[model samples]
Target: MLQGAGVVSLSGISTGAYATGIEPFRQVVTRYAIRPNPAAPWPAGLRLRIAVLTDIHACDPWMSLERIAGIVAATNALQADLVVLVGDFMVGQRYVTRIIPAAEWAPVLGGLAAPLGVHAVLGNHDWWEDPDALRRGGGPTASGTELTRNGIRVLSNEAVPLATRAGPVWLAGLEDQLALLPVRRRTGRGRLGLHDLAATLKAVPDGAPMILLAHEPDIFAQVPARVALTLSGHTHGGQVRLFGWSPVVPSRYPGRYAYGHVRERSDLVISGGLGLSIAPIRLGVPPEIVVVELGAEAVA
Candidate 1:
């Protein structure tokens, strides 16, 4: 039996390192869509396929161009009307310039197309790699404006009205909580206040069914009562687990919210994410690209 509190040492670490440099690998992810049913008969017949992809951590080979391409292809096949990228789009510290480089795979992130439109928010990694630039400017100046040139819209603490068949679904994206942290610890730079929720909600009037795309699911507990659904994926489903238990997760949330599908009060669904965090190889927790079929009843 494996203890949940011991240090995990994988084979790759001996030959290489824990971070695993940067390489791309893909995993086809699946997830169930959840809704909050406050009253009788939540819209039963109406349905929508929402593709949720979180934690790309795209750093060239680490998160393969081929894999990202596969994700886009999968999303198209599912005919997902709405696509949500929760966060960790790119990763790198000093090599921020190379965070999202130009190569044959440069177009993967932006190739996604949905009738309801693709929605995304910045993750801790994205903010750490390149924050101010992805905000004021669309893309890095030196990179020849690649990400935006391809078509990915990075929303930071903002809201966009999505015209859905069922009236209008308001889509909101929050800035990285890691970005707002008090800068007191080893990883202090990425923390941010959860106040973005209130501001974004205020922007959307009353009675609009709103869906939020946040990199971290920690916000789920703090979201206003009216927000219908929230999608997140920063956990990476416990990237390398021994016998179904993950020893460590970087986030501050509870371990129950770490993997699979957890129904939190019927309004939250957090994907295990699609990429690796510190370790490139995954064990029990393979990467995923979630296809959530949203139905009338809340997923339980």
Candidate 2:
């Protein structure tokens, strides 16, 4: 099936090999004109277009600075009212020709621009692998620091309000839900995340529409109706989807939170994301830049 989709070559499949080296590098732009949802009502006249970039496990050949710059340019071309980055701006794959430092990658992402500004939330990788953050016992990962220094706002269980033509809009960025896995993995301590959803929601006053940015899609299940739309990544759409199914998903619910848009209590759009992890392989699912248009009719 993947072969028919042009994800893997015939020779590659004939050898019984699975990894498609090219799929990891290829990217597609996914756009959506959101339909009205009864569960999460859209604020009257409050329209927003969001461009989401996530799971950018920035590194050497897999996700190079040049490639990031290209993504930045591509995202900017979308002319979104807001840009939300759903984290993991750190190296994920072990085998790399060379590690690309944040200093180099940060400037590339600095190129990303939107009218509302580029906002971000840290991912599990940003917390676990950062030496400075680990050494200090908390906070300000190198990638987050550099991205902020370059004019992007990094949020950790924080919310920011934006002024739109329709009315006031709030962006709630949740910290990585799996922030303490490294310590837990290394020494059996609790892996509780620093995220405080209730506290974060407090920042949003009653009746103000909010958009939630969570790196992991699992948090979507907990998202409330006050949030009109929730954006997430980190699943990578299973990274190797075939016939619309991913065999190895990291989430506890497996396929439920694997990818694309889902609406339960709150509407959630999970980006397939721009990078890879664990292995340098992508099969049927390619990397992507997601653009979501809320209140699409307003623009029309």
Q: Highest TM-score: which candidate?
A: 2
lDDT for each residue of candidate 2 in 1-300, tens digit (9 for 90 to 100): 866767557665743344546678898998776754655646676667899999999888889888998999899998999998999988888978777888888888888888899999999888878867765656878878998999999988889988887777888899888887777677777655778888888888877778889988887778788788889899989988889999998898786899887878767888889998988888887899999998765223
List the RMSD of every prediction in angstroms. 5.8, 3.9
lDDT for position 91 in model 1: 53
Question: After superposition, which runs of candidate 1 have C-alpha atoms over 4 Å from their true positions?
Answer: 1-26, 33-35, 39-44, 92-106, 131-147, 180-195, 242-244, 296-300
Candidate that scores best on lDDT? 2
Candidate 1, 179-237: lDDT as tens digits: 53433254544434433677877777677666777777777777766666678888776
Predicted structure 2, TM vs. truth: 0.91
The per-prediction tally of clashing pairs is: 19, 0
